[model samples]
Target: MYGVILKIINRLQRNPKRAATWQYLKFIRLNRETKPLILYPSYFSVFLILGFLMLASSKGLLSKDINEIGDSVAGLSGVLAFLWLIVTVLLQNRDLNLQYNEIKDMRAASESQAQSLESSQIFQTLEYLEVKLENISEYVRQRRNLIIEELENFSRQNRIMYNGNTMLDLVDAMDYFVVNSSDKDALEFELSNIRNDFTYQSYLRIQAIYLNIEEVVVAYEALMINVPENIKPQVTKYINAHKKSLMVDWCDKMLPYTEKLRHALMRAVVKHGIGPEANRHFLKIFAEKDG
Candidate 1:
């Protein structure tokens, strides 16, 4: 019997489920309230078995008496089985609660990790865009200088005043001439010829600058759209401040000119009826500006 018990104990020690059950038993033993709940069934079973054996030994029972004892034992067994069933249900409920808590904790952890990853990606994208914006700003600065130089050279060759005068000023002068001339039709015809000639000559360089500025604006819009609502105000403020600095730089340390050359070119195109292409460009610029 001792050897059989030892073998059973060894088998239980090797079984993972049995080891877990043993650990659970130890946990229940640590709790004073749970200890009796866990041990009561075993205690009752042992005492009932000892009492039946003693009763059977003390009396030589008749056949009818044995049947009565058996019926009582069967009824007691049913009650005992019901008690064990209740204990089983309670244990299962505790296990389910533990599992539910674990799942909740894991879900919270996963969501936090996902949010952190998204935030990191957003910041990386913003840094990349900032660098791109800076490069575009530098390119625009160089192109603006080149355009000014070319304009000055053209003015010198044509013997026209270039200093302290903008393209808008030239347009105003032409408009004034056309408006005040007694032979209005003739003056208007002469001015139309000048406008067409000037627009054709200046179109390529002016268009290049306009396209670069459009790229900057497109990137700014994309940046705004992709930023999260929680941090949008901070991002917007930073971008606006950066843009102000770039605008100052582009204006060559003077007050910001707001792309006066481009605007003047567009005005000339519309007023002079350059072509379908120029008209389209003018309309697009007008819509974007208004929007």
Candidate 2:
């Protein structure tokens, strides 16, 4: 019997679950899997007491007297309970330490995965913003080329003319007189008016592009910071506030340029709206750009 108990203890030392069970037999813990061990031992204790009662009636070990049998059973039960309590406490501590180590490893893996995902998101956003900026820059270059070409053509072919009194009119009148031909005055006046109008329009367009680029850069910076999910709400609030500060009058200022760009982009998108074709195009653009 002693050899069997020693072998059981040895096996339990190798098996955490079985060891947890042996410990629970003494500890009476409110744990999920091991608590059943406490109940099994209580039932076994009752059975041992009953067996002692039967043994005294049959004149078995210790003494045939009922009082002596009861006293021996009580003493042995107390000794067994004390040993069980000590063993179980040690086992419970071991289980708790193992659980703590497992939790720490899992938390580290989770943090690493989170960081990798966050790095991926930042790389993608940066690539997208860089491509968008490149497109805007190309558009601005084309638009500026158009304006410069128009200004040159107007200067070569037309003369300035004016009918009213203002600082702008005075400048046009001076240019009209210097042109040296009666037929050129009307054309020059119209050219001057167009140049002034185009200048104002181009200034507004360039300012808007600059502002949008600033917003994109700010958003990219926010994305690159660690723990984006935890800080995203605060970052978004600041980014949106900065964006709002750039331009508040959406009705008078923003709609025309957005409408023109949106229409042109929609046309481009519709032309390449197929499966692998669109995917390949996006990959090529995103991969080649310096984000």
Candidate 3:
């Protein structure tokens, strides 16, 4: 019997909600039990005193006898008072347990909602990363087109010079003159200069292209790694507001070699007397060209 009682107590302790309801029920039972045990006994004591008072009035018993009856009633009433006290104690305990369980349930629900909110935040972060990657890819394509157009403009200018009176190098002369002049000696010096310039510019151009490609890759990685779950929207908003400035900054940081390449191209154009104004006009037109 003791083992069974202990098992029941343990189960009640494990579930506070059930324990609270059980306590409330126990208090109700106590109040019902107290009504009979307290009120009935007190009522009987009152009725017995009244009967004694009436007997004393008719028989003229001593006042001492009446006092003894009063004392006896007081003793009986004390027992009823004790029963009421026990009932009140039980009710207070039950009320406290019920309130505690309500608070516990509220806390559990709040924690569950917080976990769901965190999961939604993580999902949105991944979505933002996907969108940023797509934008970066498009931006990289535009940069590549800009580089190619500049190079194409340079080649077109060289071709125009070759077709005109001035063939500054053998590559240009060969492109235009292998049919007109068979004199191999006439092309040797210009051919050497063309070979040297071509080698140097080719190296610089290749390096610049590779560096720009690396910059795009780094930006993609930064987007993937740096965006926290809750702050992705803010990150995306800033990127969108300043995409052009951000792209220029990324190129500067990741493609420092581009400045040297630009200088080399300028030097080659100047040595061929392409002139600053002509080069500037070509750059403007190249920027306006379709990608």
Candidate 4:
């Protein structure tokens, strides 16, 4: 019996409206009227007095003079008071039942809506990632040799020119080839020198790489927008791995004309939309020359 009572009490605590009804049954309360303070005690006193008198009469402890009338009146009044208490308790339970149903329905609806929102976000992410993967794959497949050749050339030139490999060396090379051209046409003339030195080929390779920088930037922006929160870190890490070469290509586009093109590509990212630690290995060049 005690275990059963404990289980019922535990269940009541989990249901707030029903718990309120249970709490009311265990305590006496006042009405909103000013008479409340006096009214509660009066009702309680009546309840106690009637209960005591009824017990006395049942035990035959009442004097014979008052017994006949007092006993009959006590019996009827006690029965009426008990019935009224039962009715009040039932009314409280009914009110609490309405509240319980409302809360339960609201909770169910909220859960359904949240699940729908999560599903929609996931679907969008998958669609965006699919298109992005295709673009990245095609870029790599087409530009793989050009990218490798120029990066190798950059590495070799850096050691010879700077006495050590560094971003400054690469930055200076790009500026010499592209940025410091006396005029826009001068850049075409120098790299297209009449003697046809092997130097022209290298300059052309660098330009080729920079041309793809816009596509890389577009893909980066798309991932940032479309990826969901939970796995964004892993996805970002993978994307960042490829960012190193992109940055190198970025340097090529630093010339006044090239920067305009780069900006155009970044803008196109809004319309065209779109890695890992291999970036860290290459990006150390930039990191080492922060000043």
Candidate 5:
């Protein structure tokens, strides 16, 4: 019963709109209150006790028989009862107003918390991103030296190559040689945009890694005709093994740019030791993309 009283008090205190409601109004008709309905019996009992105390105290001026009680004393008791009822009604109204304000404040706090929760998002820590960059840097550090080896082996074959060309020059030349030349600056700007775009940067990085692999492919294929017929199979086997690394790691990333890279390889083949027909070789390797 005590717990039930507490629960009713909590409801009225937490939601004051309920305090002045019709059900509360009906309860308030007894000069009562939105004061947790469960406390009604206790409050009524207190009033009765107070009434009995006053009547007992008036016994000295009172007649022994109930019918002989003085009119003045009876009127005073009625006034006291009226005063008690009025005091209870005023106190209930003041408490209900305070509770309504408290409820408004609580609601505001809840709304702010909900907005904060909605706007929150998960973010990668700097350490996590740094670790990923370190891993990529390590792999590139190991693999790029092999590309230099392929070029050096070509110089051993009595061919003049690259003409002091850098990787950047080769890529820039490719745009002109394969795709047409008038819009180099525009293409460069667009590539910069792709690099900066977080959504596309990962794809761009994979493409760049594959492009490095393609450079080695071009160097190797360009020299296929230069090898003696007996040694050509060995060279093919060696180059195939190297190319497999690119396929395993990057074939999917390279698919979109396959034709562009192939054209670069074709230019290298004609300029070094192969003819137009050797283009079929690139087709074979690129065809393995699906597998």
Candidate 6:
């Protein structure tokens, strides 16, 4: 019988609702303060019954008429009902308090879950941005190498002494040759012929690459504006680290070559008086630098 009772108790404990009810009853019974509150109604009922029996025996009411007995029993029933009302009120109050605490805990857990989801979304966005930045960096690197190779090949094919010399050096040589010659028209004609042989397509490619880099930088800045303020510091730190790496690639790998090209173009415009049509593509870039 004891083993069967233990099994029943274990089963009840395994059930959530039963376990909670059992725990509450155990708490009321064991707690010093709550023990009296829960047991007082039972204690009062016991004392009232004992006192009524003693009074009936002294007055010989148990052997009196049935009408007298019924009146006494009805009076005891009313008192018991009043006591039950008080007990019911106390139990209801306790149940209400428990429900309020449960609700508070549930709300707290919900808020925590929402915050966790939002944090996850923010990090995922950062990861996506980082990936985009890496792709842009890789593209820049590849274009830089290709541009350099094309410049070297052009220099070699033209038999131009390009060792340790930049595009500006070649421009300077051409400018010197044009300025020193007495036959101005013939010199201009020769310069025009050289320009025709020059790889104009490479110039356009360099300009496109620079524009692409500028656009990417601008788009990234705009995208960052939507990042949440609370996490902006962390996001900025991560993005800035990648930006710094990109800057290094730009400065170390591409800047030198681009600068040489810019100077050469400027010399062509200022010294040689290149027409507006020829300078049209570079006008925006030059204007930005000037500003």
Give the number of the best model, judged by TM-score.
Answer: 1
lDDT of 4 at 278: 49
- Specify the highest-lDDT model's number: 6
Q: What is the lDDT of candidate 4?
A: 0.54
lDDT of 3: 0.54
Task: Score every model by TM-score.
Answer: 0.46, 0.33, 0.33, 0.34, 0.28, 0.42
Q: Model 1 TM-score?
A: 0.46
lDDT of 3 by residue, 214-276 (tens): 565466447747566566665556554444544433443434334333343434444444435
Task: Write down the lDDT that model 2 would get.
Answer: 0.48
- Per-residue CA lDDT of model 2 for 1-291, tens digit only, reads 999999988899899898888788756543444555565665666787687668666766554577876777788778678857966996798889989999999999999998887777666655654565445444434443443343333333344343332223323322332223355443332322222212222223333443443344444354445634654564455444433443221222433433333232323332334234665476346434512
Q: For each candidate, C-alpha RMSD in Å? A: 11.3, 18.2, 18.8, 18.2, 20.1, 14.0
Any idea what lDDT model 6 has? Answer: 0.61
Tens-digit lDDT string for candidate 4 (100-194): 99989999999899888877766666567657765675565445445445556765754335423334543444444443345555434232321
Candidate 5 lDDT tens digits, 63-136: 45665555655775686677667768877888899999999999999999866654331112223433543445
Off by over 4 Å in 5: 1-49, 52-135, 142-168, 176-180, 183-210, 213-291
Which consecutive 10 residues in model 2 have the weakest lDDT in total? 191-200
lDDT of 6 by residue, 7-90 (tens): 988899789799888889887766656556567887789999999999999999989999999999999999999998998898
Q: lDDT per model, in order?
A: 0.59, 0.48, 0.54, 0.54, 0.48, 0.61
Backbone clash count, each prediction separately: 0, 6, 0, 5, 0, 0
- How many clashes (backbone atoms < 3 Å, residues ≥3 apart in a chain or on different chains) does model 5 have? 0
Give residue 136's error in model 3 in angstroms. Answer: 1.9
TM-score of 3: 0.33
